[model samples]
Structure formats: C-alpha cells, structure tokens
Target: MTETADAVTTGTERPDFPLDRRRCPLAVPQEYERMREENPLAPVTNRMTGKPVWALTRYRDVRQVLGDPSMSSNARNPSYPAQFHVPEEMLPYIAFPFPAMDPPEHTVRRRMVIPEFTAARINKLRPRMQQIVDTQIDQMLAKGGPLDLMAELALPVPALLFCEMLGVDPVHIGYFRRYAETTTGRDSTQEAVAGAIAEMDEFLDELITEKTKNPGDDLLSRIAARLPDEPTLEHEDLVAIARVLVIAGSDTTANVVSLGTVVLLEHPEQLAELKADPSLWPGAVEELLRFLSILDSATVRVATHDVEVSGGTIRQGEGVLALNGAANWDPERFPEPDRFDIHRNAEGHLAFSYGNHMCPGANLARMQLETVFRTLFERIPELRLAADVDKLSYMFDAHAYGLHELPVTW
Candidate 1:
C-alpha cells in the first residue's frame, strides 16, 4: 500500500469532525486519512454544537470503540454525540430507537423486531423482491429514453418493499417518503424535522391502533401482538420502532442502490465482468457496500466509563463517533482500499457497522442490492449515463451519500 504522504503526524485536533462533501464524488474526506495516521482518537468540534467530541479514525481503534460497552449507545444521555443539533422544543420526539438504547434496554427492544429480519424471513421475501425489481424495470422500459434511475428504480423498490413490510398502503408512500427524506436531510430545519417526526408518529400511532384491532402477518401486526405481554414495548415504543425501521429500511438501501449504480457505471470493466457472471453479484454487493460506506455518521456513542484507546482515555460522559467510512477505506484493513474491486473479499468491512448495534436489516439490504444490480444488468446490457459524470448532482449533506438523480439510457 502506498503511503499517504501528506497525512498529518502532529497537531492532531481538527475543528470539524467530518469534513463536508469531498470535491471528488467517490473520494473520502482528506481529513480522515490524516487523522487515521496521526491521531486515531482525534478531538474535534461537533458542527451541530461547538462541543468537543472524540472522532476515532483508524480501523483497529474504531472497531475497539464500537464493541466496548463502556461506550454507551444511549442517546438519552446528554453527552451522546448527536448528528445534528436538536432544538429544545423538539426534545419530546427524541425517543431512542433500539440502536440508541443501552444494554438490557437495547437487547430487549432489538429482540422484539429481530424475528422480522431473520434469514428465513428475508429468504421468503426474495421471490416477491424479484417481482418488485422486475415490475419497476418494466415501468422504466415502457417509458423508454433518458430516465432518472434514482426516481424510476432505486427509490421506488425499497420504498415499496418497506410499505409491504409494514403493511402500509401503497397510496400513502408519498407521505411516508416525504417524512423519511426530511428526517435524514442535512438542510432541513429542526422545526421541519420535528414536524416530519410528529406527522410520522401520528401516522404510526394510527397504524398501530388499526393493527391492534385487525392484525395481519406484517411487521406492525407482530409488534402489536407483543404489546400486551411486553409492558416496556408500549404504544409509543412500537411507533418509534416502526418509524425508525421504515426510515432506515428505505433510505439506506435506496442510497446504496443509486450510489452502487454510479460506481458500477464508472468502472465499466468491473460492471461488464459482473454482467458475465451472475453468481458474482452477491460478492459484488458486499464489495460495493464496503467500498461505498454511504452512512458516515451511523455510529455515535457517549462513554459510560473511562476507556483507554490507542494509549488515550475516553473519559466517562464524553461523546465519540466511529468513522465507519475511514475504517472501510483503511489500507491496513482493506488492501489498496481505494481500488473498487467487485470480487474483493470485503466480508468484515464496517459498512453495516459491527458488534451488538450492527444494523438489524443488513441481510435484507444485501438481498435487495444483489437482486437490483443483477436484474438491471441482465435487462439493460447497454445502460450508460445520460448525463456527464461531473455535472451530476449528489446529496452531499444527506446522512447517506448518493446521487440525487442518475440519468441513464440503454
């Protein structure tokens, strides 16, 4: 691996933890590389607040910090590293999802929905998922000519799947999509986000009420069934879980699909190779996830106890963020990390994160990505970008980095 010649080896602290969108669409922030080498536990100021927090960069250091129980995932803790500043008025909507809860709370909450995303459950959904992919492709093909794949395919597939998973009516997808987009949008105001949250909670509350009376086999129904027995899993808990699952299930997967398409198109040689070998699609999906590392701020924690990392101590009550993108791109972890190799064994990359709080729907995401890429290539062998790469718009401020629209034609 070639050395990062300009890596900072002294004067560790940087002002902002995560540098804004890189000039090059596919490149990682330069600050990450410098910090990984010089200051694995770099102290940086959170952009949302002027408060200081530790940003862990190196692969080993990041992995250690995430798995360490001393690093609390409880967002209720005031020291928790929030992605954006939450206005005092919006505090009621700050309910902790399973991912943000600590210990027994997280474990109990996680188990409630674990059955829905099990390997068997995902396997059962595969046939329907394929049909979803085919139907979307059919619509795109019928429309013909220059099309935005982001609108026509990537966004719809996951959104519709999420609707199906939650037993939400297809007609209400527009409402759901709006709230999902705004919640993760960097440009949205706290008031706008709070409004979205309130609207979504109101919707979920109604859904839960309906499910309680007339239950189905869908995820919401299952949660409803558990409500009577699981006292901790109350009405509000169910609503919060549903909201988080829908937003996460739709947003992250959609971004991956859009960004993955961009990566494959940019590297035609690799794209062609995958097209020739259908079996390679699964590995290709894993590689793309590892290579992309779209959700840069997925894992943030506050220290519950003084934890020593790379010779420094993260004192109790201090906030920390594990830079998953840096870990995925670390040369020590992924050799020649910058090279986008479809066949690379990227099994352990931190794309879905690691340890207890690893993304619950990781398997579901993998299946969707594999099916979408394979089906797309098989259907449109000549597909290429309709717009110039440099001119394309990207959602730089989004929690997930992805193309705003990928204009493509066959």
Candidate 2:
C-alpha cells in the first residue's frame, strides 16, 4: 500500500520518518536522495509517534515549507510531529520555547533577543571567543592527547561562552551540560527529562531574580532591564528565553566543533586549503555546515492551513518535517552535493535553516565555529583521529546529530 501525498496510510505502509544516518555520519541519510528524486513531498510515519507526516526533501520545497507563514511551529498543536514523548505534566516546560512558538508572540520574543546575536555583536565578542577557544586548546595541550576532544574542548568552549553570555555562574556549567544532554537524549526517560527541566527552571529563576536586582552587560540583564517597558513579558518568560539560549547555544555549537573537526580530518586537502589561506576559514565553516547538517530533524512543523508544496498539498493540520540535511545535499541547489568542497559557494544552505524562525544565534555559532577550527588546527597541525572513524559513536538518536566523543591525537 503506497501512501500518496493526500492519502493517510497506516501500519507498515509509510516509510519511517528520520531515516537513520549512523552508518554514514557525515552524509544525509541515503534514503533522502531517493525521496528527493521521486516523491519530493513524501509521506512518512513518525518513528516516535507512529503518525503520518509530509517529509519535504527538495531544496526549494524545504525553503518554502520553512518560510511559509501557514506552517506553525507550535509543538502543542495536536497534529505536530513530536520527536519524543513528553509527559502531560511536562507539557508547560517543553512546549513554550521560542523555537517551538508561532506567530506574533514568537516575533515579539525573538525580536527582543535579535540584537544580542547580530553579526556586529558576535564580531565584537570574537576576541573573547578566540580567547575561550585558545584557553580550551591550551588546557588540552597541557593535559595531552588520547583524550576525548568533546570533553576537553568542544563541549566546554561553547558551554563556558554561553555561561558568560547569559550571566550564569561558570561554576554551574556541568549542570547546564547535563540539562542539554538529558533534554535532547532520545533514550531519556520522561521523568528524567522533566527532572532536568525542573532543575534548570529553578536555577534560571534564581539567576533571573539576581539579574533583575543587579543588571550587568549580559543578555539576561539586558532582557531584565526591559521588563519594565515590556508589559506582556513576565519573570517566567525571561527564564524560558534564558533556558532556550543555554540549551541551543551550548549543544549545537559543541556538536559542530566535534563533528566539523572529524569532517576536516577526513578531507585533509580541504584542511590544507584552510591552513594555507586563513581567509578561506569562513567559507570552509559554511561548507562544513552544509556537509554536516546536524539539526536535520529539528525543523518540524504543522500546517495551519492547506498549503500547496512542490509535490502535493499539505492539508491543514498535517505535520511537515523539513529535512534540512536533505535540502543541503539536494543536487538541484548544490552541484556535486556529495563532494565536500570548501571553495564551493555554500551560501543559502539550510544548515541554520531559513525564514523568520531561522536560528537567532547563527552568527554566534559561526563565530565560535570559525574561531575554534582556525585556532585548533593551527595550534596542533598534527592532530588526527586517535581511533578509527568507523569505531566512533555518533549521536544518531539524539534530537541533534553529532558524536558522543571524538578521540584525537596530535
């Protein structure tokens, strides 16, 4: 029973959503190429929920789905394709993150923090970001190799920087990391996920209070300062915003640092190009982003109204999963999409996604990625994988795609 775009199929009829890429960690799932070629808007069963969703694979269709105003990001919508199960009690905590929000409210809240992540702001913070990366590399050098790059450098650099950005005490970075991992961990129990959220909320509540009383030159303090003028925003709203920043900022950047390193090492020619020409570092970062689309599965939405896409119509309230990884690897957009060429114009890639809901911290992520890759390789020219690439454990089950650990030696 082949499921068409308009037909709602049951049981084994539909292909599973979130096709696994564990076998080829650096590439989008092989199934995506077929879907893009055949049924651009293919129907799939959500592995987590066993519900049908319209999977958008083509580059243009993905952009349209993401940019379309009728597509709602609200996970609370009954028909939305939920990645994991959240207990009813945990719904309040899980549902309201700005990324999962829709409409004018999302616009207002997103606008409030837009100034913090502008290219100028990230550029201003570049020196500090460089120092952070250098500090991590220095520590790694001091301790020596055969160690997990993820633990030593990849995770800490972003975690520490996010702590500084949000005015949270750096001493509590371990808790922040735990919150990120547990919340996104596919195997995490509902109770465990709820507990992590509760802990973060408690800590954020205290931090927000302190920021309100003694404002500093940080995101939380700045948002706190505006609380008086913003009548609709509440104390909890501040905590929610801070929580989003902590998880999104730390986890995604950390993953990129670890995964990007792996990709660069695999392609020494591109690595050499970066080493030879420092100016190419930025473009290399973009290409790495395109090649390693870590947030492939996070861009889930439900159509608010019947919307016509490339292949077929997404009926009102139907779930739509825009596979950013597939879009990035779409041959229609990038010629020779499988080839990891640093010089290729990889701009407009869906790595950070498209439209109003595009990642607000994209510039910050880019700066961190640029700083880390440029510095890490230059400092340790001999750095190579200590363990075989095939033996490495990739985080295929998590909400984001990355590595559990990257073993490297110089």
Candidate 3:
C-alpha cells in the first residue's frame, strides 16, 4: 500500500480522531487504510475531548468492540467519545436516549419500539412510503429541473414518511428537518444546538400528551398507551424516543438518498445495468449503504473493563471509536474496497452498526432507499448533474457525511 502523509506516525504522538476526508468526500479517509494494515486498533486523540482513544479500523475488530458487553455506550460516562462537545447541563436534551444507554436499560428501551420497525411492520408502510416518494417526485417534476434535489426530494420524502410513522403533523415537517440539520451540523453554535433540542422536546411533549388523550395508530401513540401499564417508561422517555426517531429516521435516510443518487449518476454503466435489471435494486442499495457509511463515526463507546481486540487491550475508562466507514473500506474484509460494485456481497457492513446497539430503524431506512432509487431513475431516466461534480458542496462539517446540495436536470 502506498503510504499517504495522513498515515505517517512518529514517536508516541497520536493523530486526531476523524481524519479529514474533504479531499474526497465520497471516500473513507486514506489514513484508515494504513491503520488497518499496520495498527488495527490505532490510538488517536478525540477531537471533541482532546483525549487519547482507541480507533478500531478493521471489520472484525469493530464488530468485536460493538458486540462486547464490556463496552459502554453511556454518554454520561466521562470516557464515552461524544461526537459533539455539548455542555453537561445540555446532555440530557441532546444525547440520544436508547442509543447511549447501557442494557438492561438499553434493551428495555429498544424493545419498547422494536416492533414498530420490524420488516413486517415497515413492509406494511411500504405502500404509504411509495406514495410519499411518488408525491415528492411529482412535485419535483412540476417544478422542473435545474433545482436542488436535496431540497426537492431527498429531504422531504423521508421527513414526510417519518412524520407519518410517528403521527407528526405534516405541517411541522419543516421545523423538524431544520432542527436535525442544526443539531447535527458541526458548525452549529452551542446555543443553536440547545435551542433545537429544546424545541424538539417541547414539540414531542405536546404530541405525547395529545396521544394519551386521543391515541392514534402511530408509534408514539402506542408508547403513550403503554404508560398506564408500564410504570418504568416515563413521559419524557417517550419524547426522547420520538426525538431520536425523528433525527435518525429522517436525516440519515435523506442523506443516503441524495448521496446514493450522486453515486449512481456518476456510474452510468452500473446505473444502466440497474435500470435494465430491476432485480439488482436491492443489491444496489446495499452497495450504496456500504460504500457511503454516513453514520460510521457515530459508533463510539467507553470500555468498562479491559477488552482484548485485534490489536491490543482497551483498558477500562478509555474511549474507543469503532469507525464503521473504515471497517467498510478495510480491504482485509472487502477486496478493492475503494471500488463501488453493485454486485458485491456487501452484507455485514457496519453502516447500521452491529450487535445490541444496531440501528433499529435500519430496515425502514433500507426500504425507503430502495423505493426512492427504483422510482427515481425510472421516472427521470435522463436525470444528470446540472453542474460539475467538483462544484458540489458536501456536508463534511455535519455529524453525517452527505451532499449539501445536488443540482440536477432532466
């Protein structure tokens, strides 16, 4: 492997976590490739905390760290590697509830809403999801092209679908989308982040209260109904759950849709193969998810006990970042990892992570992606970028990596 300047290590100095990839937004940081080859469990300084932590780069080591019970996901822990450095007072409002909880609490909280995202449950919503996607595209077509796809379709389709799932009023979708962008955007001020969190909590609190009095056929309503039977689940807990769902279910999927479209458009030969053979859609979506590991850096934890991984031991009280992007790009697991072949068996990629803390909304996200890609290109076969690829702005400063805008034409 050709060693890039990013991989060069000297003395005992550690590189900052989340190596810069602005040079190639669509690709994993080349530093990860070197770390995987030389130091599978390389030490790095947390950019947020300014503390040293272990960064797991290989697929096996990342899976191992994620599945191990000794690794703690509690954000309250001083050692947990937080993506953003929020004030301690604001942690409760900002930190994701279930994802940052350690089981049996995490298990209990996750199980409360697990049925809502099952393949069976999400499949039942497929019709409505398709309708939502179609409506967004119809609106887009009416407006004509030479417009930002991110604003027209990529952002709204998933936001509308998530609102439908959570029984959130469609009118409030715009606010929710803004809240997600601000809270997750790296450049957002602390006051802005806190305000967004407060606004979300207030909205969810009201929604949950309404659900209790007039329950609906939605996830939040169902959770509200359980409050009478389950004393452990509080009203705030319901709000927190819904808040996380809104952020995860919408923003992440929206990113995948926009970024994935760029990938398909950039690879016309593979795009033609997909358009010609509908059977490849599912595999194409998986490949896209694998290729663009947007949420990889979010999988972080603090070792509660000494844990042995591929490279070395992670002693208790030390933070560890299991970079899913790096693992997906690890050539040890995937040959020619940089290549984006739709037919590659990209199963077991850590895009949604693995084990207990695996993203519960993964199935729903996949279905939405498949629907968007299948319907999009079929409806607009001539869809192509309106501007040069280099001119496109990317969300390198956001918690998730994606295109800031995708100007397209047909």
Deviation of model 3 at 248, angstroms: 1.3
Q: lDDT for every model?
A: 0.83, 0.86, 0.85
Backbone clash numbers for all candidates listed: 0, 0, 0
**TM-scores of the candidates in the order shown:** 0.95, 0.96, 0.95
Candidate 1 residue-wise lDDT, 300-407, digit = tens: 888888788877878878888898988888999999988999879999989888899998899899989999999999999899999888778888877678878899
Residue clash pairs of candidate 1: none
lDDT per residue, candidate 3, 31-108, as tens digits? Answer: 887888888877787777666788899989998998998999998886688887577665554546789899887887
| Candidate 2 structure quality by residue, lDDT tens digits, 290-363 | 99898898898999898888747788888999999999999999988999999999999998889999999889
By TM-score, the best candidate is 2
CA displacement after TM-score superposition, residue 374 of candidate 3 (Å) = 0.6
Kindly report which residue stretches of model 3 are placed more than 4 angstroms away from their true locations once superposed. Answer: 1-11, 89-96
List CA RMSD, all candidates: 4.0, 1.9, 3.5
The RMSD (Cα, Å) of candidate 1 is 4.0
Clashing pairs in 3: none
